[model samples]
Target: MELVVYLAGQIHDDWREQLKQLAEQKGLPLVFKGPQEDHDRSDEIGEAIKGTQPSSIYRDHTASEFNNLRTRIWMNKADVVIAQFGEKYRQWNSAMDASIALATGKPLILIRPESLVHPLKELAQRAQCVVETPEQALEALAYVFE
Candidate 1:
C-alpha cells in the first residue's frame, strides 16, 4: 500500500531528498509532505504574499500560522511522521511534529545524531524508533509496513 509520510524539521539540509531517493531505490510507495524546502522563502513568503507588516513579530506570526495550517493538515493525513533534527539548528518544529503524530496516533521515526539523544530524551520516548541516519529511517519505514 502507498504511505503518506510527513517529513518534518531541519530545513537547512538535503535530508528530505535523501530520504525520498532511498524510498525510490527501495521501492517503497510513499507520498512525502512537509513545510517549504527553501528556508528563506519560507520565512519571507508571509511578507511577500501579505505585504510587509508594521513589525517583524507580526510578520513572523502571520507566517507561522500559515505554516502551521499546512503542517497540521498534512500531519493529520500522514500515516507516519518522520522528523529529523540536524546538528546546527534548534528544530522546535520537529519536536512539535513528533508530539502531534503521537497525539494523532500516527507512527513516528525520529532521526538525529547521538549527541542530541540526551537533550531529546522525552521526544525519543514518544517515537516508534529513534535512529541516527537516513538508511535507518528507511529501515524503520519498512518495518512499519511489515
Candidate 2:
C-alpha cells in the first residue's frame, strides 16, 4: 500500500532533503504544494515535483478553505499523512491537515524540527508513532507501509 504524506513546505532544507531521501528509500511517494511561488515558478516547481511523470508527489502547503477542500480530496486516496509541525505554527493550514487526518482515521506521523522543538512530548499521542530523527522516520515508515 502507498501512503501519502503531507509535508511542511517551509521546513528546513536539510529536513526536506532528508525526507525525499527517506521516501525514495522506503519506496513511498511524497509531494508538497503551496501558492505557486509565481505563475512561472509554480509550473517549474510543480513540474519538478509532480510533473506529468508517474511518480507520487505529496503536496504539503498551507491551505485556505478552498485549498483545504482540494487537499482533502487528494488525501482521501492516500494511505497515510505525515506532517512536520515544527516551531512555526500556522493555525489554519497545519491544524486543518491534522484534523482531516484525524477525522479520516488515517495514520499521521508528526515530525518536529531538530532545532526548534515542540513542547508537547507526545506530538501525536494517537499517531501510529512519533519520531524525532530521520532514522526514526524510516522506522515509522516501515510500520505504516507494512
Candidate 3:
C-alpha cells in the first residue's frame, strides 16, 4: 500500500534514512519531507525507494512553502502522514504538519520517543494513532493504508 510520511526536519538525518529503508523493505511507497540535501543522497534515497515499490511522491518542497496554504493543496492527495510530534526546534515544521494533517482529516501517525515530552498527546489521541517507535509507526501506516 502507498503511504505519505511527513517527518519533521529537525530530527536526526539517520532517522529519515532508517524510515526510508523500512518503507522500502515493506514494499510501501513513501513520501518524505524534511531537510535539504545534496544530489547524491537524494538520488540514492530515491533509487532505493524506486527499486522495491510502486512510485511514491517525495515532496522536496519546504514546509514553509506550504505554510498552511500549499499543504492544504497536497494534503488532500496524501493518504497518511507520519510526523514527529511535540518537538520544538527552529527548523521544526510542527505547525505546517499539524495544520495540514488536521485540515485534511487524513490519518495522522505521530511518532515520539518514550522519553520525549510532548504537548500534542490529545492531538495524537485524536489522530489515527500515536506511535512510540518506527515499528509502531509502520504498523499504524499499514492500518491507515488498509
Candidate 4:
C-alpha cells in the first residue's frame, strides 16, 4: 500500500526532511502533497519582486487552487494519511485534512511532539492512533499498513 504523508503544520525544512527520511527507512513509497512543498519557490519570487511595481509581482492564485485539488486527489489515492501536527498550534488545515481522510475512510495517523500541547488533540482522538514521538508514529504506521 502506498503511503501519502500530508504534512499539516509549519513547514520546518528539517522536520519535513526527517519525516521523509522516516518514510524512506520504512521502505514505503511516500508522496508529500503539502502547501509548503508547492510554495517552495514562492519566497524567492517574492524577494525578487520586493522592489518591483505591485503589478509586476507574481500572484499565482491558480497554483494554490491547483495544489488544493492535487491534495484531494492524492488523499483519495493514499492508503493512509499521516497528519503531522507539529508543536505549533496550527489546526485549521490539518483538521480539515483529517476530516477528509475520515470521510474517505482512509486510516489517519496523527503525530505530535511529546513536549508540546497539541491544539487538535480532540481531533487526533478520532485517528487510528495519536502518537507523541517519531517511534510511536512509525509504530502506528506499521499497524495501519499491516
Number of the predicted model whose lDDT against the real structure is largest = 1
Ranking by lDDT: 1, 4, 3, 2
On TM-score, the stronger of 3 and 4 is: 4
- Of the candidates numbered 2 and 3, which has the greater lDDT value? 3
What pairs collide in candidate 2?
Answer: 30-57, 30-58, 31-57, 31-58, 31-59, 32-58, 32-59, 32-60, 33-60
- Find the 10 residues in a row with the least total lDDT in model 2: 56-65
The parts of candidate 2 lying over 4 Å away from their true place are 8-14, 26-63, 88-92, 113-123, 144-146
Pairs of colliding residues, candidate 3 = none
Q: Local error of candidate 3 at 37, Å?
A: 5.4
Indicate whether candidate 1 or candidate 4 has the larger TM-score: 1
lDDT of 1 by residue, 1-146 (tens): 89999999888889899989999998888999998888777788788878888898988987887788889999999988999988999999988888899998989999989999999999899898999997899998877677
Positional deviation of residue 42's Cα in model 2 after best superposition, in angstroms: 9.1
- Cα lDDT for residue 97, candidate 4: 80
Scanning candidate 1 in windows of ten residues, the lowest lDDT window is 37-46
For 100-127, candidate 4 gives per-residue lDDT tens digits of 8888898887766765445666776788
Provide the lDDT at 21 for model 1.
94
- What residue runs in model 1 are displaced by over 4 Å at the alpha carbon? none
Candidate 1's clash total is 0
| Model 4 worst lDDT run, 10 consecutive residues | 50-59
**Top TM-score prediction, candidate number:** 1
- Model 1 lDDT, full chain set: 0.89
